[model samples]
Target: MRHARDFAVTVLVLGLLGVVAGVLWSLLAPRPPYVMTGEGPFLADPSTQALIADDGWFAVVTGAIGLACGAVGYSLSRRGRPLAVVLGLAAGGLLASYLATLVGGAVNLAPASITASGKAVSVFPGPLALTAHGVMYAWPTLAVGLFFALEGIAGYRDSPLRTPFGGQDPYGPLSSYDISDR
Candidate 1:
C-alpha cells in the first residue's frame, strides 16, 4: 500500500514537471526564420541548423528534467518496492515527454499576420518543432537509466562483497582479523 502511494506520487510529480519542461523548451528553443510570401512560408536560410537546434534544445531540457525525476523518485522510494518505483518512473516519464511536446508546440504557435500583395513580405520565425521525432524519448530513457545507475551504486555499497579493505571479505567477520594486523 505504501509503495503504491509512493508510486502514484512519483508519477504525479513527474507529470507536473513535464509542464515546466515544456515552458522552458519553448522559451529556450530557437525557431527557424521564414519568409511569408504570397505562395507560402519558406525558410529564410537554406541551412537547417535552426530546425535541428530546436530539437536539441527540447532534448536537453527534457533530459535534464528526466534525470531530476529519477533522482527524486529514488530518494522518495527508498522504502518502497524497486519494481513499482521503476514502473512509476517509466510511466511518468512517458506522460511527461508527451505533455512537453504538446505544450511546447502549443506555446510556439506561428505568429498571425495579414500579408497584402505579399511578395517576399515579412520575415517571421516558424513554430518550434522536432525534426527528429526520436528526441521525444529523451525523457523516459534518461529517467530509467538514471534510476538503474543509482540503484546499482546503492546495491554495490550495501553488498556483502564490499569491505573496508576495498576487496571481498572471505572470512565473513570483520572482527576475525587481529587489530595489530593493520
Candidate 2:
C-alpha cells in the first residue's frame, strides 16, 4: 500500500510539473509579429503563416521538457530505484507533459486581429491548436537515455554482487583489483 501511495504521489508531482512546463512554453513561444489588415475573411493571415514557419519552436519546447524529464530520471536513479521504476517514472512524466500541453493549448491566449476596410480590431483569444508531433516523443526517450547514462556514471551500488548460488561477493572481484593500478 505504501509503495502504491508513493507511486501515486510521484505521478502527481510529475504531472503538476508538466503543467508548469506547458504553461511556460505557451508564454515563451514565438508568435506572429504582424496582424491581418485586409477584407474578405482572410483566413490565411500573417499570424497563421508565422505559426507555420515556426514549427521548429514546438520541437524546441519538447526538447526542454525532455531535459527536465532527464533530470528527474537521473534523480530517481540516484535514489537506488530499480530500472523498471525509473523507466515507469519517465513514462509517467512524459504522459503528464503531453497532457499538460493540451491544457496549455486550451489556456493559451494570443493576440489576434480582424480587419474590415481600413479599421482593425485586435483581440486576445485562445490559440488555434496545440499539436504533439512524433518529435515530442524524444522527451521520454531522452529521459531514459539520461537515466542510464547517469546510473553508469555514478556507479551506484544497490546491492552486493551475487553469484548463481546467491552468495554475495562470491568471486571477490573487487578485492582482486588494486585501486592504484587504474
Candidate 3:
C-alpha cells in the first residue's frame, strides 16, 4: 500500500512539474523574428538559428526537470520498491514532456501576420515550437538514466565487497594468491 501511494504521489507531482516546465520553456525559448508582408511571413534574418535555439531551450529546460524528478523520485522511494518508482518516473516524464510542448506552444502562440504598409516591414515574433520532435525523448531518457545512476551509486556504497581496508575476499575469505600457493 505504501509503495502504491508513493507511486501515485510521484506521478502527480511530476505531472504538475510538467506544467511548470512548459511555462519555463515558453519564457526561456527564443522567439524567431519574422517579417510580415502581404505575401506571407519570412525570417527577418537569413539564419534560422533562432528557431533551432528555441528547440534547444525546450530540451534543456525539460531535461533539467527530468533529472530533478529522477533524483527526487529515488530519494522519496528509498523505502519502496525501485521498480515501481522507475515506472512512475518513466510515465511521468513522458507526460511532462508532452505537456511542456503543448503548453509552451500555446503560451507562445504567434500573432497573426500584419500587412506591411508600403515599403515598411512589420517584424513579429514567431511561435515557440519544437523543430526536432525527437528532442522530447531527452526528458524521459535523462530521467531514467539519472535514476539508474543514483541507484547504482547507492548499491555500490552499500555493497559488502567494498571493504574499507580491502582485506576481505569474497571466496571464503581465501585470497586468490593464498589459494594459488596451496
Top model number, lDDT = 1
Clashes of each: 0, 0, 0
- Runs in model 2 deviating more than 4 A are 1-6, 32-42, 46-49, 52-55, 110-117, 121-132, 155-182
lDDT of 3 at 113: 50
* Per-prediction CA RMSD (Å): 5.7, 7.6, 4.3
Clashes of 1: 0
Clashing pairs in 1: none
Instruction: Show the lowest summed lDDT stretch of 10 residues, model 2.
Output: 123-132
Pitting candidate 1 against candidate 2, the one with the higher TM-score is 1
lDDT of 1 by residue, 1-182 (tens): 97787678778888898889988999999878787667898997878698889899999999998998888777866875777788888988888888888888778655645454654257677877788999888988898899999999999989876775566565877777798878
Per-prediction TM-score to the true structure, in the order listed:
0.79, 0.61, 0.79
> Which rank order by lDDT, best down to worst?
1, 3, 2
For model 1, the superposed segments whose C-alpha errors exceed 4 Å read 1-4, 109-120, 163-182
- lDDT of every model, 2 decimals: 0.83, 0.59, 0.82
Better of 2 and 3 by lDDT: 3
